[model samples]
Target: MAKMVTKSILMPAALAAALDAEARDKKISLSELARAALSDRINLAAIESRLIARLDAQDEAMAKIIALVSSLEAVDEPEGGVTQ
Candidate 1:
Protein backbone atom coordinates (compact mmCIF):
# COMPACT_ATOMS: atom_id res chain seq x y z
CA MET A 1 0.00 0.00 0.00
CA ALA A 2 1.14 3.53 -0.73
CA LYS A 3 1.73 5.92 2.13
CA MET A 4 -0.82 8.71 2.26
CA VAL A 5 -0.34 12.29 3.38
CA THR A 6 -2.99 14.82 4.32
CA LYS A 7 -3.40 17.97 2.25
CA SER A 8 -5.77 20.92 2.28
CA ILE A 9 -7.29 22.88 -0.59
CA LEU A 10 -9.71 25.76 -0.80
CA MET A 11 -12.52 25.96 -3.36
CA PRO A 12 -15.68 27.92 -4.04
CA ALA A 13 -18.67 27.09 -1.88
CA ALA A 14 -20.69 25.90 -4.86
CA LEU A 15 -18.01 23.45 -5.91
CA ALA A 16 -17.67 22.16 -2.38
CA ALA A 17 -21.42 21.66 -2.15
CA ALA A 18 -21.44 19.77 -5.40
CA LEU A 19 -18.66 17.53 -4.24
CA ASP A 20 -20.52 16.86 -1.01
CA ALA A 21 -23.68 15.97 -2.86
CA GLU A 22 -21.83 13.70 -5.21
CA ALA A 23 -20.18 11.93 -2.32
CA ARG A 24 -23.53 11.41 -0.65
CA ASP A 25 -25.08 10.04 -3.79
CA LYS A 26 -22.18 7.67 -4.36
CA LYS A 27 -22.25 6.48 -0.75
CA ILE A 28 -18.58 7.30 -0.34
CA SER A 29 -16.60 9.53 1.99
CA LEU A 30 -15.71 13.00 0.75
CA SER A 31 -11.99 12.32 1.12
CA GLU A 32 -12.24 9.15 -0.96
CA LEU A 33 -14.18 10.93 -3.68
CA ALA A 34 -11.71 13.77 -3.78
CA ARG A 35 -8.77 11.38 -3.94
CA ALA A 36 -10.32 9.42 -6.80
CA ALA A 37 -11.24 12.59 -8.68
CA LEU A 38 -7.75 14.00 -8.25
CA SER A 39 -6.16 10.74 -9.41
CA ASP A 40 -8.40 10.63 -12.49
CA ARG A 41 -7.66 14.28 -13.35
CA ILE A 42 -3.92 13.70 -12.99
CA ASN A 43 -4.09 10.68 -15.26
CA LEU A 44 -6.13 12.56 -17.84
CA ALA A 45 -3.61 15.40 -17.85
CA ALA A 46 -0.76 12.97 -18.52
CA ILE A 47 -2.67 11.36 -21.37
CA GLU A 48 -3.48 14.74 -22.89
CA SER A 49 0.18 15.78 -22.70
CA ARG A 50 1.26 12.63 -24.52
CA LEU A 51 -1.42 13.13 -27.18
CA ILE A 52 -0.30 16.72 -27.81
CA ALA A 53 3.33 15.63 -28.15
CA ARG A 54 2.35 12.91 -30.61
CA LEU A 55 0.37 15.40 -32.69
CA ASP A 56 3.30 17.83 -32.74
CA ALA A 57 5.67 15.08 -33.88
CA GLN A 58 3.19 14.02 -36.57
CA ASP A 59 2.90 17.62 -37.78
CA GLU A 60 6.68 17.84 -38.15
CA ALA A 61 6.78 14.57 -40.11
CA MET A 62 3.99 15.76 -42.42
CA ALA A 63 5.79 19.00 -43.11
CA LYS A 64 8.94 17.10 -44.04
CA ILE A 65 6.95 14.79 -46.30
CA ILE A 66 5.27 17.75 -48.04
CA ALA A 67 8.64 19.40 -48.64
CA LEU A 68 10.06 16.20 -50.11
CA VAL A 69 7.05 15.79 -52.40
CA SER A 70 7.28 19.39 -53.57
CA SER A 71 10.97 18.96 -54.38
CA LEU A 72 10.22 15.79 -56.36
CA GLU A 73 7.49 17.56 -58.31
CA ALA A 74 9.80 20.46 -59.08
CA VAL A 75 12.40 18.02 -60.37
CA ASP A 76 9.78 16.28 -62.59
CA GLU A 77 8.75 19.55 -64.26
CA PRO A 78 10.05 20.11 -67.82
CA GLU A 79 12.01 23.24 -68.76
CA GLY A 80 9.96 26.35 -69.60
CA GLY A 81 10.74 26.00 -73.34
CA VAL A 82 9.03 22.57 -73.48
CA THR A 83 5.45 21.44 -72.82
CA GLN A 84 3.76 17.95 -72.76
Candidate 2:
Protein backbone atom coordinates (compact mmCIF):
# COMPACT_ATOMS: atom_id res chain seq x y z
CA MET A 1 0.00 0.00 0.00
CA ALA A 2 2.51 2.58 -1.08
CA LYS A 3 1.65 5.36 -3.48
CA MET A 4 2.33 8.98 -2.88
CA VAL A 5 3.26 11.36 -5.66
CA THR A 6 4.19 14.99 -5.64
CA LYS A 7 6.08 16.98 -8.22
CA SER A 8 8.07 20.17 -8.44
CA ILE A 9 11.71 20.17 -9.46
CA LEU A 10 13.73 23.29 -10.23
CA MET A 11 17.14 22.64 -8.75
CA PRO A 12 20.22 24.83 -9.20
CA ALA A 13 21.02 26.54 -5.95
CA ALA A 14 24.25 24.77 -6.63
CA LEU A 15 22.13 21.85 -7.71
CA ALA A 16 19.95 22.14 -4.70
CA ALA A 17 23.03 22.11 -2.53
CA ALA A 18 24.20 18.98 -4.21
CA LEU A 19 20.94 17.23 -3.71
CA ASP A 20 21.02 18.22 -0.12
CA ALA A 21 24.45 16.82 0.37
CA GLU A 22 23.50 13.58 -1.25
CA ALA A 23 20.51 13.27 0.99
CA ARG A 24 22.58 13.69 4.09
CA ASP A 25 25.13 11.12 3.07
CA LYS A 26 22.66 8.43 2.12
CA LYS A 27 20.35 8.48 5.07
CA ILE A 28 17.98 9.06 2.18
CA SER A 29 14.70 10.93 1.87
CA LEU A 30 15.16 13.93 -0.40
CA SER A 31 12.51 11.90 -2.12
CA GLU A 32 14.65 8.86 -1.74
CA LEU A 33 17.56 10.79 -3.14
CA ALA A 34 15.55 11.76 -6.16
CA ARG A 35 14.40 8.23 -6.61
CA ALA A 36 17.90 6.90 -6.45
CA ALA A 37 19.12 9.40 -8.99
CA LEU A 38 16.30 8.56 -11.33
CA SER A 39 16.93 4.88 -10.91
CA ASP A 40 20.58 5.26 -11.82
CA ARG A 41 19.76 7.09 -14.98
CA ILE A 42 17.41 4.36 -16.09
CA ASN A 43 19.94 1.67 -15.41
CA LEU A 44 22.66 3.48 -17.29
CA ALA A 45 20.49 3.72 -20.37
CA ALA A 46 19.97 -0.01 -20.35
CA ILE A 47 23.65 -0.74 -20.02
CA GLU A 48 24.58 1.54 -22.86
CA SER A 49 22.14 -0.25 -25.13
CA ARG A 50 23.71 -3.59 -24.47
CA LEU A 51 27.21 -2.32 -25.02
CA ILE A 52 26.28 -0.90 -28.39
CA ALA A 53 24.96 -4.24 -29.62
CA ARG A 54 28.12 -6.04 -28.61
CA LEU A 55 30.25 -3.46 -30.37
CA ASP A 56 28.25 -3.85 -33.56
CA ALA A 57 28.87 -7.59 -33.47
CA GLN A 58 32.60 -7.17 -33.19
CA ASP A 59 32.60 -4.86 -36.15
CA GLU A 60 30.97 -7.42 -38.42
CA ALA A 61 33.48 -10.07 -37.38
CA MET A 62 36.45 -7.95 -38.35
CA ALA A 63 35.01 -7.37 -41.79
CA LYS A 64 34.95 -11.10 -42.49
CA ILE A 65 38.54 -11.51 -41.39
CA ILE A 66 39.65 -8.75 -43.69
CA ALA A 67 38.05 -10.41 -46.69
CA LEU A 68 39.75 -13.73 -45.96
CA VAL A 69 43.15 -12.11 -45.76
CA SER A 70 42.63 -10.29 -49.01
CA SER A 71 41.77 -13.56 -50.75
CA LEU A 72 44.94 -15.33 -49.57
CA GLU A 73 47.06 -12.50 -50.89
CA ALA A 74 45.67 -12.88 -54.39
CA VAL A 75 46.99 -16.43 -54.96
CA ASP A 76 49.65 -16.83 -57.66
CA GLU A 77 52.29 -19.57 -57.49
CA PRO A 78 53.80 -22.49 -59.54
CA GLU A 79 57.09 -21.25 -60.86
CA GLY A 80 59.54 -24.19 -60.63
CA GLY A 81 58.78 -27.32 -58.66
CA VAL A 82 55.58 -27.08 -56.67
CA THR A 83 51.96 -26.32 -57.49
CA GLN A 84 49.92 -28.82 -55.49
Candidate 3:
Protein backbone atom coordinates (compact mmCIF):
# COMPACT_ATOMS: atom_id res chain seq x y z
CA MET A 1 0.00 0.00 0.00
CA ALA A 2 1.10 3.54 -0.66
CA LYS A 3 1.39 6.07 2.11
CA MET A 4 -1.42 8.63 2.06
CA VAL A 5 -2.17 11.89 3.79
CA THR A 6 -5.58 13.37 4.49
CA LYS A 7 -6.62 16.66 2.92
CA SER A 8 -9.74 18.81 3.06
CA ILE A 9 -11.35 20.98 0.44
CA LEU A 10 -14.11 23.53 0.83
CA MET A 11 -16.78 23.96 -1.81
CA PRO A 12 -20.05 25.78 -2.24
CA ALA A 13 -23.18 24.06 -0.91
CA ALA A 14 -24.53 23.30 -4.37
CA LEU A 15 -21.38 21.58 -5.56
CA ALA A 16 -21.01 19.62 -2.35
CA ALA A 17 -24.58 18.50 -2.57
CA ALA A 18 -24.13 17.38 -6.16
CA LEU A 19 -21.02 15.39 -5.34
CA ASP A 20 -22.68 13.77 -2.38
CA ALA A 21 -25.67 12.80 -4.48
CA GLU A 22 -23.43 11.29 -7.11
CA ALA A 23 -21.53 9.37 -4.47
CA ARG A 24 -24.76 7.93 -3.08
CA ASP A 25 -26.04 6.98 -6.51
CA LYS A 26 -22.84 5.05 -7.19
CA LYS A 27 -22.87 3.42 -3.74
CA ILE A 28 -19.40 4.64 -2.91
CA SER A 29 -18.07 6.97 -0.26
CA LEU A 30 -17.80 10.61 -1.28
CA SER A 31 -14.08 10.54 -0.59
CA GLU A 32 -13.47 7.70 -3.04
CA LEU A 33 -15.64 9.23 -5.72
CA ALA A 34 -13.96 12.61 -5.41
CA ARG A 35 -10.49 11.05 -5.47
CA ALA A 36 -11.23 9.03 -8.61
CA ALA A 37 -12.87 11.95 -10.40
CA LEU A 38 -10.06 14.36 -9.50
CA SER A 39 -7.36 11.90 -10.53
CA ASP A 40 -9.06 11.14 -13.86
CA ARG A 41 -9.47 14.84 -14.72
CA ILE A 42 -5.83 15.61 -13.89
CA ASN A 43 -4.59 12.64 -15.94
CA LEU A 44 -6.76 13.63 -18.92
CA ALA A 45 -5.45 17.21 -18.80
CA ALA A 46 -1.85 15.98 -18.82
CA ILE A 47 -2.52 13.58 -21.69
CA GLU A 48 -4.20 16.36 -23.71
CA SER A 49 -1.22 18.64 -23.22
CA ARG A 50 1.17 15.95 -24.42
CA LEU A 51 -1.01 15.19 -27.43
CA ILE A 52 -1.14 18.87 -28.44
CA ALA A 53 2.64 19.15 -28.14
CA ARG A 54 3.16 16.07 -30.37
CA LEU A 55 0.73 17.34 -33.00
CA ASP A 56 2.32 20.79 -32.97
CA ALA A 57 5.72 19.19 -33.50
CA GLN A 58 4.39 17.32 -36.55
CA ASP A 59 2.65 20.39 -38.04
CA GLU A 60 5.54 21.27 -40.36
CA ALA A 61 6.03 17.69 -41.54
CA MET A 62 2.33 17.31 -42.32
CA ALA A 63 2.26 20.59 -44.26
CA LYS A 64 5.27 19.48 -46.33
CA ILE A 65 3.64 16.14 -47.18
CA ILE A 66 0.43 17.87 -48.23
CA ALA A 67 2.29 20.37 -50.39
CA LEU A 68 4.30 17.60 -52.05
CA VAL A 69 1.12 15.69 -52.91
CA SER A 70 -0.56 18.83 -54.21
CA SER A 71 2.42 19.61 -56.47
CA LEU A 72 2.12 16.22 -58.27
CA GLU A 73 0.96 16.38 -61.92
CA ALA A 74 -2.72 15.64 -62.42
CA VAL A 75 -3.38 12.73 -64.77
CA ASP A 76 -6.17 12.76 -67.33
CA GLU A 77 -8.85 10.10 -67.31
CA PRO A 78 -7.61 7.13 -69.33
CA GLU A 79 -9.61 5.58 -72.24
CA GLY A 80 -13.16 7.05 -72.23
CA GLY A 81 -12.81 7.82 -68.46
CA VAL A 82 -13.84 4.23 -67.68
CA THR A 83 -12.43 0.69 -67.96
CA GLN A 84 -13.42 -2.89 -67.18
**Clash list (residue pairs), candidate 2:** none
Candidate models: Cα lDDT each: 0.59, 0.53, 0.53
lDDT of the structure predicted as candidate 1: 0.59
Query: What is the number of residue pairs that collide in model 2?
Result: 0
Clashes of each: 0, 0, 0
Best by TM-score: 1
For model 3, give the RMSD to the true fold.
16.4
TM-score of each: 0.48, 0.28, 0.34
How does candidate 3 score on lDDT? 0.53
Give me the candidate number with maximum lDDT: 1
Q: List the pairs of residues colliding in candidate 3.
A: none
lDDT per residue as tens, model 2, 1-84: 111111112222434555576578667778876677687832434444454454456556766888888766555434553456
Off by over 4 Å in 2: 1-38, 52-56, 63-67, 70-84
Judging by lDDT, tell me the better candidate of 1 and 2. 1
Candidate with more favorable, higher TM-score: 1 or 2: 1
